[model samples]
Target chain A: MNILLRHRIILPVVSLAVLLAATFYMQPRAMSYFGLNLLFNLAVPIALATIAQMMIIMVNDIDLSLGTFVSLAACVTATFLNDAPILGLAILLALILSYALLGAMIHAFELPAIVVTLGMSFVWGGLALFILPLPGGVSPGWLRALMTVKPPFAPMAVVAPIIIAAVTHLLIVRSGIGTVLRGVGGNARSVQRAGWPVIWLKALAYGLAGLFGVLAGMALVGLTTSADANIALRYTLLSIAGVILGGGEFTGGKVSPAGAVIGALTLTLAASFLSFMRLSPDWQIGAQGAILILVLTARLIFSRKGAGT
Target chain B: MTNSMMLFSAAGLALIAGLAEADTSGKRIALSNNYAGNSWRQAMLETFESTGKQAVADGVVAAADAYTTSENQATEQAAQIQNMILQGYDAIILNAASPTALNGAVKEACDAGVTVVSFDGIVTEPCAWRIAVDFAAMGREEVDYLATRLPDGGNLLEIRGLAGVFVDDEISKGIHEGVAEHSQFDIVGSVHGDWAQDVAQKAVAGILPSLPDIVGVVTQGGDGYGTAQAFRAADRPTPLIVLGNRQDELKWWAEQRDANGYETLSLSIAPGVASLAFWVAQQVLDGEDVAKELTVPFLKITQDTLDEALATTPEGSVANVTYSLEDAQQVIASAR
Candidate 1:
């Protein structure tokens, strides 16, 4: 049990497995391939958003604008990307560069990340609203096809998250640059003393977060086939919750990429499970709260037990 | 005619129509609602459940299930719609999160031969049947009503709905058009209330100190009560505020009317339009020649009908009227 708790990924994995089993038990039809596709399709963008949030959290910063940033990206994708692909790609690239700049400014000025990102949330939301005020923009055909593609042996919903988890794990958990990046969060002064560029590392982390946020928005638009300014606003809270559920902490550089992906899937399946339970609408939201509390309590208990010995 | 008489006649017609053809007995229908945080939406869900239960008891549909996304996100709603399709529901009655964001999932359902009927928060997909309110007209009419009360049209405060929503833009456009036509009324200040009473109250309170004396407040429903509260809190004279058909708004209007004869207009989309969407989905599943688009008339309350509306509307709910099959057919025929 101590070993399992030490692994950190086991908690999220067990939570996801339990939720999946419950969902299938309630609605046996959900065990089929198409059923899994329908159940987990929306989890793709959510997983992406979670990874983006994890990136920021790993750097010991929280991004309050992740939701609006993703919304802005979706708006840009649906409008500019559909009409003029070159312009859209350029704008998206510019957004990532802006994120890097934001990180640099924060580090250079010693600005609070929460306050800065909160202010940027409004900026991104306003920009998204300006671009697609009426929520009517078509997604590009290729993006839609890619999102909805039915790869054999597993649905895109299942396949995409595994790929995201594996790739991010390789990049953030198994690389030399990743060590430097994590080092910045672990002990910035020590890392700077070690001759690593702390500001550049922070900028890289923010840039990667921006990239994942953009991908999340694009994947969302691809699935929805259109864009709206407020389309992915709930992603802010969901992504934060995903990171915490995946054993990522707020103050430390402790994070697990695979666990975060599993955490996203768990959150998605929890909703599905609740729906299949046919709880009344009044209790449905409350039941979701209860599920979150239950899982977090279990996590807390396990962690405490591991610490005591 | 009295409201009950009209309902009785509509039900009678529906009974006759039901005897004539009942091809939807085996169909299963689902309601994919995005949000239900407000009294209006709660009323809508309740109305749908009650009406759907009646239909099932009468063997109109085999099953009528309703699912609402916990988070009011288009992505969540799209997933809910797809799950409904996979669950083998023959039809889906949707209160969509966005006008266009659910089109992909909606199109997939259409391809699977599922009948989709969206109401109130309607979708823009061509394959789905839309039961929409003429919200712009509702907004225009608010100004027109105020025009009658204040002929010399003074400064008007515009309380809009959520920003960036299609409904908000349409209604605001209509209000602006009305202001253009009237030429006497000027909208001096505008604020987005997000169609919530508390939000409206806060926004109005924040802006009232800066504005000059306001004679009338033009609102997009759900904000009138809050605007009134803000006026009271600020010790300013209450303007002639048009109201949404929320029960609290109506009750407040009644109290003001009784105390000082404060006369005003109340108008909003009935929450029971979900029932209308349900019937439309059933009709489409029954292979009826239903049009892809239909308009639902917004419910309006005047000084004369205020008492009646207040009496019928439950406490903390909205004024509602569940549509019968005959009414659905009438709407379809009108569209044709």
Candidate 2:
């Protein structure tokens, strides 16, 4: 239990610290308030996305469609939320309900989450395409104002990650509902014996995941000031990688919202850092992958050392 | 003088000189496009549909059918082409998903006596006629305009298009080549805009604090307005922002021209060139000899022409000029 706890928090903190130090050393300006904002400006959406992925992982399920779902939400947010508020709100609510139904269906039918989501990605993407056939839409005035709000003390970019991580950590790690969701992942049989509906818990987790996905999509659209069906497509793999990089396991009810945010930040910073270093865009992706592998290896080593003790 | 304008005028003459060589009246034309995710593709489709209808009115072709696939898969596009062949289209104007992935289908269409012409994002099939603007020249022209605007050396911030794309690489190469000639200019910063307005705005916003005084900004299509917005939002003096052919950008440029006395050139691959492919197909069907490859000049819009483009351009649509048959003949002749 001690090893598990340490791995959950300590590994990600260490990795984040190391990355921060390296970035500051290479580009001192990144330490400034404005510089930090520029570096982390896009991290809020990514953090929300990682948390969404974390919720699904807590239920020991994966969502291959999370990225496209986020994109769909952005499409909805950009078009409906701006033009027809009532209709847009109704559609978004229906989307959340559909996610809950999807979870229930997955549990009842004994479907693999991967296959279900993989198929659903097309549905979500096609829906987004139907809504916004082209990559042009006006972001709602309020959302844009919210995204660009510059706090007096620090840029919202820097503050957003912390708030997102804290709130998600509290809800998913500290709350009683969170424990039930994780319990479902750990052992549905026991949870069922305890007179709890396993399917309900699973559905609840999926609903929460959908909520966060919507928030992520909206935040991204707010920042970018427009929406496209394929805009957030890169988030699918990135969110999964963030969860894993934060010491979350693929199996068991082992996931950390805080760690996932840190992992996302680490990854975002790595890209920005590389850009500041003036590396070719061709080399940036490879370099970011290398960083991921190195961090994972170090985490593995540290876990092994703790296990030996 | 813009070389393209000069070249275009010369081509216009050739087209007028060669107008009587072909008459295409009853050919069925089909437009097969790979994606419609961006304004560029949407504008291209609209242009093709409208121009094809015009061709029908002029007895240039019998029917013009357009098909667009949202999925950016080569197989999907190739399948669409095969179905078009099966549908008995006399000619297929294609904007391919890949450079070579559609070769097999294109070859089949050609073997079946179908005239195939690809434009914008074109194909590499030996049997198809390809129409494309010289992207390198566009890039070079962007820098050349910058050089003339800022004769003395100044820092240039290059907002590149999507990373790892062939067009992106080609344009970037051309920009570098153009910059190499002007000893006074230096590119101090670069970022990928992904050819989207909002993406470019966010990226430019992020990098602005880190960059020194930027004298000018160079970008591919779909991002110029966003770059200008970033500058305006940052309260920085708006530099010379080279524009692509989006109506939004052109409109914004006209506004800036009036308000801030801003002046800059606008250049883009007229999405209407898809219609050029249709016209080419018509010529081929009329038994006129056409080249396997055709290079079309990018439309260069100056202050004098900017208003005309904006006036005719529909709101929220890209500004564009279609090629007349006379102009089309000139384009075909330039290949030789």
Candidate 3:
């Protein structure tokens, strides 16, 4: 009970409640029809991107390429998915593998993730453009439907990611891998000297990030029903906002699934709130910018307290 | 006596050559079109450069200066106009970024005896002739076309271009006016799509699942491209009619419907920018007395016309759409 209270679960729960309360303010017509749909649209991609970002943060590294990772996943999947049901799974697998390899290359050089991912991001985005020079490319119908078509508020889009988040929580907290990853993120050289395969640990981190990036790519394909270069650019910054405010470090050493979930909800709510206020869409960009600044400020204050304490 | 005759011959020859040169020089012309920094604007520039070269070959004018920017910085455009006036160009053609903003510059050019004809985007101050595609008519056409298809009148969603823009506001006004006559066609509301496909798609994805009976959709920009993806995935005949841009993708959709022998009615108002480009150039050259506001009427192409045009198009390409400035002058003249 003490752990539960101290762990900041209340912050997330309360934020989710605030989001729900804001929902009451929407037009009844829009509330009934589009509110959950909008949430679902943001959920899958944001969650996957957040998780991918968290993996990098755990190790004190950052994959600024997450948005690009998503685009590459879509470019690969869309170019090859071929409307076959089996092709969908193949595309998903190929995307994760491709990013994993990209991660491995970066890992081999012991390079700062921001620098590596930045270059990789451009390469991946270029691949996306090359694959779909125009907007009318075909996305597999089954995945697109599962991702987009809503059945009330209980859309697969919203539910599937929540379930994945739950499964991830059980794996990380209940398993031995979670403890080692935490220790490694806090100090990699120490973990390495202590005989933990540090490269594999970071490799696992990159692979996990890539896996989630592909998931976001697939989810985005469903939501928009068309994949393009711009989708990646939109989420590039938001994923960082999710992780930083969730209080995750740059290298994946210590992070919480619950906090990440809350971070996603918080970002989504903030956007919905501004949009609901009928503020010009321009304000949406400004509001997001402000949120990032506030989150960074809080992180600084919290870090100072931790040091002083 | 022999030295005097030789000197006279040299002076006479010089005088005759000067007369011949003056007769052949035609007139000097300059263009200062406001730029919107869009592909459509780029297409206009390409046409302008090509047309100017062609006109020069035809001796339309001595030369045409092409000045472009992302926004028609009225100050910069005014400076260019001043330069043209100083250089003594016969006239200037313009596309103003803002009607109210360009007042001082436009007035300056007019005072300098520089003939000014505006096209694409126009100014209210009325320096000279305003050449444009009938934006209001395009809006009415979309609403009327959609209502005709869905007589029982279902929920309608309007996706407009840049908010508060002449195209956006006038089309919206025209749509409301058109729908006012019908009991069935009710417009839900309008949202700015910014003439971008991604924006329109995201809006549609959010709006579509909620409104189960969206009988009609109105759009400005490549929104129809995004809308088609959603409808195709749902595997339905977008039973809802579309008021969409005449882009390659939308043209393909129209062709698909025609191939299956279904009547696809899409009302696309091809930009009057092309005709306006030519007309403004000619007017500036010919020194024609033109009006301050010239509204060019758009051709209301239906399935019949589209099918006929498609058959004639180069394989896999939509046929080029051409609009005549005279046709616009006639329509706007009649409307007034």
Candidate 4:
């Protein structure tokens, strides 16, 4: 591989570095343990959710129900898990099973992934509304404690994202099963010709997505210490954007867990940075969108240059 | 135009009140709610239902019906209102989706001689009677309270409600207006909390690092306890957090005061105002003179009142004081 091709991650990495530098330059205290904790505390759940979306994207499928499913898990965590531990555990497991079943059903009917997930979003959202019905529930004490755990020297919020990325990268990039999953997404016919059950691979990918989505939901509850059925609805679009921003390709099999994590962090920080800069709430959404588009456009130019060579 | 319509309704009401033999038995009242996503809205719906049933028992109204449009859409709510009108309901108690989007439908209802009582997110139709707490006043009052606490002027983190929302805009403007009155208090930063506990907490957490020493926080409803929790979690000295009237927030503030001498004022639009709206509709149906616009006071929960409010408030409920039929009468009198 050429030098330019070898440094494929340089664009996203450089963009992330620049953003970090700018944020720290403006608010130097953000480099401190406490400051870092305050800044990145909410990113853990977002990173996990992005990874969930990334996994589905790896299989060339989009999970529109991802955010609602996370909300469902959070509702369960805040209500059933806090009040009735055993029942909550059962429901959470059942939720993951349902995701796997959804994947199998989609494959069986050769349905458009978008339609199926879109339809299921309501199903999951309805179930969430049924369970909690209100934006009020207490997360368990232990979970709350877990979210607020302060380590010496560096903040857990800062470290957890790196560890999450590394572990996901190890599982999906280095391991043999990872190859099968990506292969199924990239070229299902080729994978099937090699005696791999493409159907099972698709289901496993969805199952992994569900697992990560559950983690995201629990992490979110931990941070806020409460649950609402509609709290994380905005995450569906954000997670998708994170995946795309992180160098994840839609044609399938090309995704970087580290890039996805960085993408999520970048998006989270963009909003926080806008708030810090004292921009009006009306401009925050538009400003964040502009930043995402700008960064991605720069990355695209870099990729084009590399391809041209 | 709405003023003239209001005057017309007021005259009609006065005429009805003057007639000693006016009958209101077997009148139907319908509740049209937009969304049921929060505990406060659920509480509002519950109060509306209960108050309606009590009215039924007293033979003041024949039946009370409620329809909640799961989505927060003006078109959907307007459709429901039209349906209520077609059903020949005498009154429609509405928590509207938009301020002006329901005006046409409300006018239709008014034209059909249906008493339209709107509250919370109210309609702009002058023909419809509105009952709500003064939101801008709540914001200004919160800042006034904070100013007294911080006489020397200090940095304040403003946790505004949902972005682009009329309530958020009004209350935020009021906060700024109050802050303008006292130039010492500086708003270090501001962010939209979407009026949800978790969202407010997370948004606060994100911006805390960039902010200086925040002496106090002013917030809207559904956000107070979570803001307090965020401070507690960060291991920072809890500041003068002005609260919205959520029962959990009251409970938390009480616990804090008991444990550590923490003190703060709480204020919010009471969910029971729904019941007040109900009583007003019923009174209007009973041929009693009622004002077209009723501005109910928000619940002001202080250290002295916190205990009583929390004691009566059920778990998972907002801190509220229910208004009685007598209280409704007083409100009507005051409005007049």
User: What does candidate 1's lDDT look like per residue over A3-23, in tens digits?
Assistant: 552568888989899888888
After superposing candidate 3 on the true structure, give the runs of residues whose Cα lies further than 4 Å from its correct spot: A1-6, A26-34, A84-92, A148-153, A295-309, B1-336
- Estimate, for each residue in B103-187, the C-alpha lDDT of model 2 and write its tens digit: 6567667877889999877777678998876888889999999988898869999989999777899899989999998868889
Q: In order, what DockQ does each candidate have?
A: 0.49, 0.01, 0.01, 0.01
Residues B170-242, model 4: lDDT tens digits? 9998999999998999998998888888998898888887878889998887788888888877878788999
Query: Which candidate model has the greater lDDT, 1 or 2?
Result: 1
Model 3 vs truth, CA RMSD:
24.6
Error of 3 at A143 (Å): 1.0
Q: How many pairs in model 4 have backbone atoms within 3 A of each other, for residues 3 or more apart or on separate chains, i.e. clashes?
A: 1
Best by TM-score: 1
Which segments of candidate 2 are over 4 A away from where they belong?
Answer: B1-336
lDDT of 1 at B14: 69
lDDT of 4 by residue, A196-251 (tens): 88778888888889999999989877765666687678679889989888878798
Q: Against the true structure, what is model 1's DockQ?
A: 0.49
lDDT of 1 by residue, B1-336 (tens): 689976886685566566534678888999999998877788899999999999999888899988988778887788788778777889999999999999989998998788999988889999999998887898899889988999998999999999977789999999999999899999999998998899999999999999999999999888889999999999999999999998899999999999999999998889889998988888888777888989997788999999999999998778988888877888886687
Q: Identify the superior model by DockQ, candidate 1 or candidate 3.
A: 1
Report the CAPRI category for model 1: acceptable
Model number with the top lDDT:
1
lDDT of 3 at B279: 47
Tens-place lDDT per residue, model 3, A1-309, is 335323435445555565567645553322433334444445567777888888777777777778877876765555567455577677677666766666566667877778988888888788777777643344667766676565655755456667866876775555688767766678777888889887777777777888888888776655544455544564677787776655555645667766676677677656655544545433556776786576667556655765577
Task: Tell me the lDDT of model 4 at B23.
Answer: 67
